[model samples]
Target: MFFNHWYKLVGMEALNLLESFIQSAETGSFSAAARRLGLTPAAVSKNVARLERHLGLRLFHRSTRRLTLTTGGEQFFTQVSDPYSALRDAFAGAAQDAGKPAGVLKVSMALAFGREYLVPLLGEFLALYPGIVPDWHFENRPTDLIRDGFDAAIGGGIELTEGVVARELAHTHVVAVASPAYMKGRPLPRHPSDLAAFDGIVRRSGATGRLRAWTLRNQVGEQAAAGHRARLIFDDPEAMAHAAMHGLGIALLPMPHAAPRLESGALMRLLPGWYADNGPISLYYPSRTLLPPRTRVFVEFVVDAFRTKGLARRFDGR
Candidate 1:
């Protein structure tokens, strides 16, 4: 029994055991490591305990508040971390090289933006790569890429975490828009300051939980507050757009959400010369060097599609 256990702790069988240890050591918590590995904390703790028994070395000094590394753990981590990462990357690269893009490609997206824009391209994507399956989660808020176990995410205003990177899909901007009916009798704003006269359908910030304010700028280096007197406020931009389309009030909206409505004449752009820089809409994923074939292809496909469709120019508030 002892010989069997000792032999199992070496070579090929050790890879799975080391994965739990490396992740736990790096994160300094079993729960955080569990999230990254898609396992429960108890499972991770057990794996570490099992490894310690096999090695006859205590790896961590555990407490309710924290898991601190023992001397043995620190030495082991320093010796194995780099080589383990390299081994994992090599295995991933080999698997990617062995075949075409295949298996589930999980992605997180912003709710309305994905449905309105990206959903239209799904048929083409799946048809081209039949082996790949898409699992998408659409939500309005920013997500932690590593903690959430997402393969990739599409949205704006994302803060990058360590071991994650983003590619700029488009430069995003916000514009003021209202239905034509709402603007018809009302005097059209000649300047940003003139917006104070109109009723505003404003968006509340999810992070701050307060009404968002806009500072609009023009080409000649002039800036002014939108000065919209709030009539209806919503937590979601989609809701604000919906209210605007029904002529509830003028709304400050990102170009992606406003573009379709503007083209269809359901909404009219207010103050064409003035807009706010909202930052880049990016494709966020775990390490570029470690990307799977499915993720790499999807990223390329989206980037190419945006270029082909002239979405970058359309999204710009020019």
Candidate 2:
């Protein structure tokens, strides 16, 4: 029994060494693996070296700039990557069964949506799950949920990838809005085509570097237009809203972003019946068979919050 126990201990150490090597290979550097694994660079390198010795194969081509995996290493990585990920997730799920949600919950979200809808609820979420730390980034651009190590992300129109799933948090609608001051003497747009006559506040896509066109639909049908006479252009939704509020021009904005200003009488919805269907705002995460408790609970919390506040339908302009 003592010999068996010793053998098992050695096997476990070998697994750790393999794990370190895998991290190094995946991150392309021992230093990056060390940061991820909370180990020193020298320690990670030592572990990888030990792994290479045990296998009797050089695993990486080390250079001043970066580490590249050897042919043998690449083959081994392909075999182990999926199983390693599954094992780690299983262990994490088991750890999370301790009855209280804990650890870091990293989230990426759109800035305007987070500020208007998500930020205010975080105080209550922390109050409820004090053990969970919220590590959140609010940006306008899409993020790689897995590569970036995010627990989850919230955004609209996120392209679904293999091994990732999205839960619909709410549907978002877009509307044309302008400050009442800006339209004080200007004739209200009687039709979608009339928007061409006004100065427009446009939003450019950060990822594509293209100006987003305004697409509106009503009982009649869909009408698409690009604002060529842009009075102001911004990549951020908040900045566009502010510019519209300052009477810069007519801005096509998301309902949630414009809702507050509209309520305060700073901005008025143009062609109220005509609006754009952007898509659902979704919470995206890896589709693990057993989700971590922190991620599961946060997803539940956000869904409940939107339901309780009647935001899901309201955001859709219902």
Candidate 3:
């Protein structure tokens, strides 16, 4: 009975050695597999040798030229590697969940969107998932997602780019708004060109100012006419919104930002018959098959939030 117990212990040690040997073979280097298993190269090599001795088969044909797995080793690796990999993934996932979801999640977003919409939303997201800590960057210029090491990004005018997956979180339309005070006696713009006659306030990169060339579509003409250069320019939509409220001029801004004022009748829409292009506000991330859990969770959250907020309504009729 003591010998039987001894044999069982031996068998378990042999199994451990076998697992180590398989990992070394699959990696094709003792040092590489050692790094993966958190063991020394000598230890991995020793276990692989013991495994080969027990099995009575050559596992690797070691040469100065290369570390080549023998035919038997290759067959074993092909059959077992997939299951072993799956097991490792499962274990890692379990470990991550055992504690808090621990990892740095980098995000890139538009300055205005980040400040106005996401700043508050992010606080809620963090409160809900205490394990996640977000490192967010906001910029006005176009960004390279991969070069910046961002786990994900949110922005307007999402271009089709390779190596990334993009999903539209919401639809946003550009509308011209002028203060009720400005429009009191002046005729509302019946056409796109009519905007040029009024002073226009613009927003870009958090600064409010005047802009040049406002693109407007003329339904009757069946074409778009680019408005003349702006005499006044500024950054920050809220500033522009406020300016329009104070009767500064006509401002083109996103629907959500302008919606409240429109509803309140503080601002009136220009060129109501000819609509501006309502594009997507999108969330994008790398297109790797195995997405990190945090990225997946955030994307799902944003999708659900937009749907719940009726984000699609702005572009429905357009």
Candidate 4:
């Protein structure tokens, strides 16, 4: 408020660009400021450059190790810092008070599971919060949540980096399933090793390109190798699931993709007692004490929808 009483602010860019200047001024390093801003060092440098161009003053002395504010930079920072913070706080307070999340929500999701299950929930999600605009990407691959600039991601076995957190949406359990037509003449496997006697619709690893073998685990904590002979092979689970449903052979498929078919009688679980527990499909986001309201509400909405819609249990491979 002191600065408010003393100074008239510049253009619109100043408000958005000032924070970058202030962060770099305080940290003395673009790398440090970038980390705080969840951006690349070059981006923070560019932001400060834009601010400098707007103000027609060189704000920082370029150095090999750290930045030092110019005399003019020092004066400007001192004048604007408190008012900038006050302006930020005012926006923050109003946003919290409104409790109406409105933003372009960016998200990454697994293709098969997202299509089979989550896509249906979009209408309801939008109906409840009409202001939110979802920009969704569906693909079968890993994403760097921060570098990729996604607000959140729905996935399984995503490597969590520092300053990121996960909330499990469902167990990413893989179960062996076969079309009923394929299983009609074949005897149901009595044990894990018995699967080897049957034809296998296996998955070739997308990351490694090697065949994915099943190491089955039972409820009693017993473990055994599946070693089913490969009758058909694919790198994508959706394709492998399609092959299995068409009676190609048994496939080791994650429950999210397999559950729909199993329920519809298009596919049936094989060796019911055994499954591979592949970590969990989770809602992942960058960890911040004060998460952006849009992202926060989205996380809450998905978790609540999963619980109420019985998707949690369905996707658990029970």
Candidate 5:
């Protein structure tokens, strides 16, 4: 009986050790894992060391800057990570019941797109799912969803990482736009080559910190009109659109942002046939067999909204 009791205690200790080791491995530092666990860095290191000794294998190669997993550790982590995540989800699921999707739904979104499309839909979404609290971040730049603890993110050109999945919400296309007031006196550009003579309001990429090129494509071929006279440069697409609206210059703007103004006769398409395909805007979240109720509901809501409102087709500029 005493032997069996001792073995059970050792088994429990092993589980704790493995948990600490996994936390350290995932966060890339004992200090980070310690912060998550509300423990000291030394305690986290001790736990990992105990786990390594118990397994009779070196799990990580410790360096001054970072801790990297050994081959055995990598194998172990791959085997356990999913199951561990599922276990956590299972616990979370138990706390909430069916028909009541309650919790904080943390989301990241692009500023202009979210403001134009998503923000308006929040009232209806909140009404439908009263249990859910929407906590959203709207910015020009992409966010690290996992590290930053986002439930989901909506934007185009998000970098896919391990444990992440994306669902296409809409296709995005860009077109050159200018206010009628701006184009009144200027010579109308019948061809791509004529753009060189006109002033351009350009946008710099938030991710790369470089001025974006105006690459337009049609039956003739894809031509990047890089030699336009840049009268103004801005980082945000909305800012560029506003500048173009006030007759600043022709701006290569996303179709979604330009559509309203185009409909209102506030902006005119510079070249009807030529456009830049920016690829699909997607809703990205961590892949899991069982997603959180709040996240699942929000995803469903957004997808349905896009389909019902014809947003996908509109974004495609069809």
Candidate 6:
């Protein structure tokens, strides 16, 4: 009875600071955690210190150059993050039973995919599960689920990382698309080599803005040459699609993102014979022993939604 009552009266500040401390530990920088929360470095430091004092244990060994979690800090953070996350999920489930999903479900999603595909689906999901609220972080940059506290993310080319669990929610194909105006009687590329002549929209490297190699695969599964370069470049896929739509150049984009334009004949698939890794899009979360019922329900909802929609279809079939 005392335990039940105590859980109910737990203050938000303690939990918020705990979450902040976890982020600071993961990123190894108070300033980074501050930036994420829109707080100053001093504020983040103070909050963590407060939480540490409350627990009567030093959570981090701070220095001017680096912040490392102390042995106790490491154990405390690791042990607490799961229950804290679960507590939040449980509260949300209770709210849902009364007719709403009431917690912040942090999610990271690709810019283009989020905008063109996921955005449309949210309204329907909210209508069905009004208690759940999503705090969506849209970016072209790759997300680190552990460091970032995201409940789930939808991304292409996901490499299975340690301490993370992923479901292959869907698979999709990449298409080389260009605007009709961009084509303007220009000779079409017959092969990947001919792509050299055309301007290309590209994904930027994580460390630097340098263009990344686009890998293409053929029907026989022979990997195409790995180093196709781009002339024009963009970091965000949506920007690349927009640029391609405005007659800037060719783009290898996810089929769903390019669907409306292609269907309207505003953009056309170039070199249909060639194929590339449409990388399996996945829903990833922290590999935990106990996933809360709310998260389980939402994950199932999302996976079912994608599967039901036939999300992996390629352009050739259309």
Relative to the true structure, how large is the alpha-carbon lDDT of every model? 0.85, 0.81, 0.69, 0.81, 0.80, 0.73
Off by over 4 Å in 6: 1-59, 69-100, 184-231, 314-318
- Point out the higher-scoring one by TM-score: 3 or 6: 6
> Which candidate would rank higher by lDDT, 1 or 3?
1
Q: Lowest-scoring 10 consecutive residues by lDDT in candidate 6?
A: 1-10
Candidate 1 lDDT trough over 10 residues, lowest sum: 89-98
Candidate 5 lands at a TM-score of: 0.76
- Comparing 2 with 3 on TM-score, the higher-scoring candidate is 2
Q: Model 4: how far is 74 from its true place, Å?
A: 16
Question: In candidate 4, which residue ranges exceed 4 Å CA deviation?
Answer: 1-11, 15-49, 54-99
Order of quality (lDDT): 1, 4, 2, 5, 6, 3
lDDT string for model 5 (130-203, tens) is 87888888887767776555789999888998879999998888887899999997778876667777788988
Model 3 lDDT per residue over 1-318, tens place = 222222433644745675677666755778766755557888988988876666666879987555798888787667666655565445435535435454556788877667766776777777666777788888766766654446788887656578788998877667777887888788877766777788878654422333434455545646566354354466666667888888878888777677767878888877775656657788999886556667777788778877876655743323
**How far does residue 26 in candidate 5 sit from its true spot (Å)?**
1.7
lDDT of 3 at 309: 67
How far out, in Å, is residue 263 in model 4?
0.3
* Candidate 4 lDDT over residue span 21-71, tens digit each: 887887788887775566789988998897776567889998999899999
Minimal lDDT window, size 10, model 5: 1-10
Candidate 1 residue-wise lDDT, 89-141, digit = tens: 66655553236677678899998889987899899998877778898888877
Residue 259 deviation, candidate 5, in Å?
1.9
- State the weakest 10-residue window (summed lDDT) of model 2: 1-10
| Two-way lDDT contest, 2 vs 3, winner | 2
**Cα shift from native, residue 78, model 2 (Å):** 4.8
